[model samples]
Target: MLEKYASFCYDQIGSYILDSLDYFEDIRPHLSKANIQVSLPEYVSAMVLSSMFVSITTLTVLGSILMIGSGIAGLIYGMILSLISGTLTLVGFYIYPSIIIKSRASKIRDTLPFATMYLSTLAGTGTSLPKLFKVLSEVDEYGEVAKEAERISRDIETFNMDTNEALKNAAERTPSEDFKNLMWGMNHTLTSGGSLRSFLRERSDTLMNDYRRRVEEFSETLSLLVEMYITVVIVGSIIFTSMSLVMTTFSPNMSTGFIVRLQVLSIFIGLPMISGMFIVLVGGLAPGGIR
Candidate 1:
């Protein structure tokens, strides 16, 4: 019996060690990969989980304590509230990561055109691909793209991975189709004796034209959006103000708190939202074109 127990313990320990090793290997590449710079914060993940549990537990405990004074009816209500709170907490944890990832993807998309333009310029100037990577790495002002390029350059120079492999690794890290396509074309050019400089220039031209068309579309849409908002705000304000005046005439003793609240809400909420919409519209229209 002792021998069987020892054998079982050894098997469990070995399995645990193997699983940990596999996890480490998977994360090891991701930590240093080129494309995506930020890792999901381990501390934040832990804190989020802990806080969620604490919140539910605290709410449950407080409700239970209060219910003890009210007997069976309060106990039932407290249990329902605890269940609702715990469910909501679980859903929040599930949704937050998805939202954050989507937001990050949008930011990455915004940066891609600029990175492509930078790369195209280097490619067009008769710089070899590896040298272009090195140049981008050295360029301090280019932000995340520069950092990503530098990682690729490092992988190539230190590990002797071919440009294609490094680029493939980068695409995997980023998980962006745009980056993947660019890397694919670049790798093909490097390996197949094709003219990379011309390919890059042509791609740059294509992307630039598409970007310009998008800007034009956004600009045209903005005028209509602005008109719509102005009409809504103006008409609503007029109607609401006239109704309030009529009400005041009818109910002279009534407190004007509702009107004041409406006015305050319109000024605080509508004005800021409208301004934000305008800024978004302008940003889309111009984009500063990647600079």
Candidate 2:
């Protein structure tokens, strides 16, 4: 009886330790949330994506082997290594583009509202539309937008470019519709001699309202998504935990026991994370207009 009890205590302790390790593994990817920035060089970013592909391919193969209950063959298996290398090269191409798009979107989203405000204020100040942009470009208060605006301003000041040319350059650089429309409005006002201040004022108000509405909409959508995610995590945790219990009940020496366990680990543990990432991507891609 004492021996049985001792075995049960050891099993329980082992189970707890495994559970803790699993929990950490699940949250590890999201623990270091990277900020989207425009600092990295294109080539360096590509290299990083390549590295991620290589790493993920190796991990997948090792994981798949574990899942299939296949032990690696003797020293330096060429087939596995070659397969991983090919997989990495294939996957790396797609990963870099996705990362680049996401990063660009993040930076654009951050700079948008401020650019609207600056343009609005510049318009309201009775400066000519081109001069307004010039003033904005010179201002140091804004970060990325200021840098971009300064670039536009330089084209005007140094290149002696027309307002339309400079504005078009700005729009081309950012690839944001907000700036594109701003350029359009400036061009229209310049050509037609419309009230630039009124145009900017309307646009600024619209952008602010749209920004608020987008935030509200995203909050509502994300609240629902979060609820769904939590439900999935809970249900999945329960299911895998039940499976773990079942595994514990069965003979530990089964040929494919560890494989089954790892598959369970991937599904229950890895799936929530993959789901969360898709949710974040959806949120990023959701169509939102800045008035």
- Number of clashes found in candidate 2: 0
lDDT of 1 at 221: 78
List the pairs of residues colliding in candidate 1: none
Highest lDDT model number: 1
lDDT by residue (1-291, candidate 2, tens digit) is 423433444444443344334333422222112212222222233333444457566656665665455545521353456456756664554354455444544555555676777777766666765566677767665555565666777788899998788877666555356756877776777789888777777877876777787778877877777777777766866787687667667957654667577767777668867687866766564533422
TM-score of 1: 0.67
Candidate 1 residue-wise lDDT, 170-246, digit = tens: 77765346656777888878789988877777766776676677678767777887788777677777877788878
Cα-based TM-score, every candidate? 0.67, 0.53
lDDT of every predicted structure (CA atoms): 0.64, 0.59
Give the local distance difference test score of model 1.
Answer: 0.64
Per-candidate RMSD, Å: 8.5, 17.8
Once fitted onto the true fold, the runs of candidate 2 whose alpha carbons sit more than 4 angstroms away are 1-106, 128-131, 138-144, 172-174, 246-291
Candidate 2 C-alpha error for residue 240, in Å: 2.9
